[model samples]
Target: MQQSLKTAGVLAFQRSLYATDAQFYSVLPHQQEKPVWVIRHGIRGTQNVNKATEKEFSNIQITDTAKLDPTAEKMKVVFDIKFFDLANSLFACAKGKKDKEKDTVKKFRATYDAFLTRAKDSHGLKEVVLRYVRNCTNGRWLWRNLTLASTATITVVKNDETEHGLSFDAVALSRKGFTDYTADELALAELFVANLQGYATDRFRVTALLDFGMPGVQVYPSQLYTSNKPKGFARPLYAVGAEEPVRTVEDVMHFQATRKMGQAALRDDKVANAIRTIDTWYPDYESIQRPIAIEPQGVSLELQERFRIKKASAFEIIQKIDELDPDSPNGMFMIASLIRGGVYSGE
Candidate 1:
């Protein structure tokens, strides 16, 4: 309990909410099934001031007294690990002029024709393939309104009951809104909503401490993205173009057609091949889960019984399930069933 809340300075009220060890481990995904939980446990710097004066605060500083000397003790914890949600922190890959400066994860090097491929076939494929992936990484926005219920507001980092510490991470403002804003112009909830809509962060692994009312309720993330994002989470795009296939891949080949604009009923197979390239979520901000009945877990289970065959790997079955149930509002059930089935798959 003492070690649970380690951040030096947290809010007074937040310092009182502590969870036990048992509660924190409940969410940890199995090692084989675990997704990447990039944990960053360091105090970051931010500027705050008096409400009336709007001046820099002398006492408000980050931990690490070596940096602030006498005032370091006055610094407060910003993000709470034990009580915060990690799902929302997974940012998309950015592809912007700024990002292009570094030739590394620079940008999606799709041919112009490939850009047109997306522009023609998928409704908002252009935005998804281009701008979304281009600037997936660096945007700080959330979806929230001030009038939302306190119940909707989340205390991301609460104070530690057994230790002298506070959390500086973040809280899940219920499912609709956020209690705080990392940016002055945006709330955490608003930031998340904007980000989700703007980019496709559909695949994610959440590592969090769901200290809802218990101690140490750990919820390891099997899938990075959660099953609870509302409809229209994908941001809307405003562009001028028609969607269809290029009958003649002759003039505009894969790389050539990506940016050219045209509309027709027959989609070119070249576009299909181009899609194969974009299928993987990596290298861009594309949604991994499709909206078709891919996996068919129920059918698979029945088949296992009838054929008397050992069940396939839970991951395999889940992928198949995702294929079978693409209609699953981002395939929520498919993901859950996979997590459960794999966790107990008699490894």
Candidate 2:
């Protein structure tokens, strides 16, 4: 595995927007540079929430270890969970593109104020378990329960450049030490992460994205199950033909994580795949003889032939969208539908 820094100091700074790329540079002080190949996870798409979750699993489980785990001991049962980037829905409605500046500001302030009030707890817990609802039985993996209230340090950014007019960065770290955690807890945590990494590598072939220092280009995750399937569990009766099925609580966690990663991959991959296709066809967007239209979503392309443009006229069609209309929808998203349905130059 390519070596990368994974110290507590580094991990703490990972969520800091102020942290520089130089701070995360992988080169060791005395070691010589070595070239290596890396597989990339596709960008998270808005539509493929399930797929996005998988990508994040691969990211945290596989890439974090192969490239970032400095301690020989695999990912500890105790790990940091950052909530800032993860909670997109909480702030999405605070500022709509069509909303006036004053209205957006008002919405943001009110929402944040209410959120802060509700979120604050004297006990320092953010999540709660109702008496009627059953919680996870295992203490080792309690952090996975999205409902548990773990102490978190939240960073709120207010600036003109930041998205949603208001932004937040929250991190919840497992304070328990390895020495204190029971053997079953540690083993279960390790097995769960390892399985996720294996699922990503085998299904999507995203070793490059999991590597350090790779380009930000997005890659698409596959929904198709790999022939080399996850073993030790039998497929449930209701989950027939499902590439991946939830056989246990651990499996459910992995399944949910994979969905989040898929959403992220879908959003990111649309543009990444589009740029790749256009670059391959025209060498660069600037070099094209014909002007190409781009929606905020991305260019149109295929998964297997991601570098190949779906149609020469896709750009022209998108250009004809009613830009003057306040309610006009932008060009179509270029990830799932484009990949599944071939494009036609003819309208």
| Number of the predicted model whose TM-score against the real structure is largest | 2
Model 1 C-alpha RMSD to native = 28.8
Query: Model 2, 305-338: lDDT tens per residue?
Result: 2222433333332223222111112122221112
Root mean square deviation (Cα) for candidate 2 = 25.3
**Model 2, global lDDT:** 0.22
Per-residue lDDT of model 1, residues 241-342, tens digit only: 352344565655453322212111111221111112211211111332211111322222212322111233223333233133323222333222221122
Each model's lDDT? 0.23, 0.22
